[model samples]
Target: MAEDDDIAERRLAFGRAFIGALPHARALGMTLVDLTEGRAVMEMPYDARLIGDPETGVIHGGAVSALMDTCGGAAVMAHAQTPAGTATLDLRIDYMRSATPGRAIRAEAVCYHMTRSVAFVRATATDGEEGRPVASATGAFTVERGR
Candidate 1:
């Protein structure tokens, strides 16, 4: 039990550090909110600079995509069988609605499947609205096993 807890702690720490090291993640003000086995949650505070439309005050779809991609990678890294590093191979995001102004966006991702060389993830982004997501994504990531 103690060993498993220690492993989880170390993985979580690594996930945080990995996110902190990304230049884009930092620029977007992304924070790793949670990391557990095969799952991760990240948040990005609403920033005026990230607004796509000056009139609507809505955040850019690009920013939301970055958040989801980053969150997906974090989920892959949190998986028990994951390797030393991972990279995005492909990601498909579907936008459902614009994020509400002044509300931070949260993204949750789960690494649902893994092979020796790849991981599959699904993610959702929300902005304080229950059952309504700003965007949803499905992604495939490279799992670097031996490196």
Candidate 2:
């Protein structure tokens, strides 16, 4: 790894140590790909049982939203610069296209602002295709200050 990347690995290691442990996260096959000051990427393998539209074989909108939401909050949490807890304030997901059932979905988040108590984020979910977004989101999350 490059020098900067090595430093980032240490920071992300810290983030992974904090507040990333949730049982449901593992159950849903969520994997944290990277954690930087203002960016994050996560992915999950496609599961047929997660599809709400079984007949259409598309990933569920709700599941898509959850994936987006988690990345958004995780972005803020990773960049929080203080000892604060974080929670989703609002998660708005727009489904641009259906996701392929057999393909894994990846969600990427970018944090534009991290205030004392709120963090602003934007994210996108994709299945490695051109002009096809499984979902996209923009939202803010509350950062609970202090231990």
Candidate 3:
């Protein structure tokens, strides 16, 4: 039981440190909502400064990409037996629709697979809706062995 508690504490510490280390995450108002084995959830609040189309009040695609990427990295880190650190090797995002105006975007990422060298993650961004995603993404990340 003590060992399990230690592991849980370490995981929480890692999540906090990872989120704090990213400047873009801070600037974009990214918040770490949950972190557990193989999954992570994050949220980014809409801000006027992040608008891509002033006329439409849509947040920029770049912001969404950043959120997905960060969420993916967090998922990789959360996976049990994950490497010491990971870097995104490839990320592909599909924009299904623009985010709802005045709504915060939430991203959930799952590290579905991990091998010796890479981790595979799938993620989606939504504005507090069911079955409707503003964007979806798949990514591969390099797993650094041997801390």
C-alpha lDDT score of every prediction, in listed order: 0.93, 0.81, 0.93
Model 3 misplaced regions, further than 4 Å: 1-10
Question: What tens-digit string does per-residue lDDT give for candidate 3 at 1-147?
Answer: 999888877887779788988998999999988888989999999899999999999999999999999999999988887688899999999999999889999999999999999999999999998899999999999999875
State the TM-score for model 2: 0.88
1 against 2, candidate with superior lDDT: 1
What's the best-to-worst order under TM-score? 1, 3, 2
Measured by TM-score, how close is model 1 to the native structure? Answer: 0.93
lDDT of 2 by residue, 65-86 (tens): 8778778877887774742677
Q: Show the colliding residue pairs in model 3.
A: none
Per-model C-alpha RMSD: 1.4, 2.1, 1.8
TM-score of each: 0.93, 0.88, 0.92
Q: How accurate is candidate 2 locally (lDDT)?
A: 0.81
lDDT of 3: 0.93
**Candidate with the larger TM-score of 1 and 2:** 1
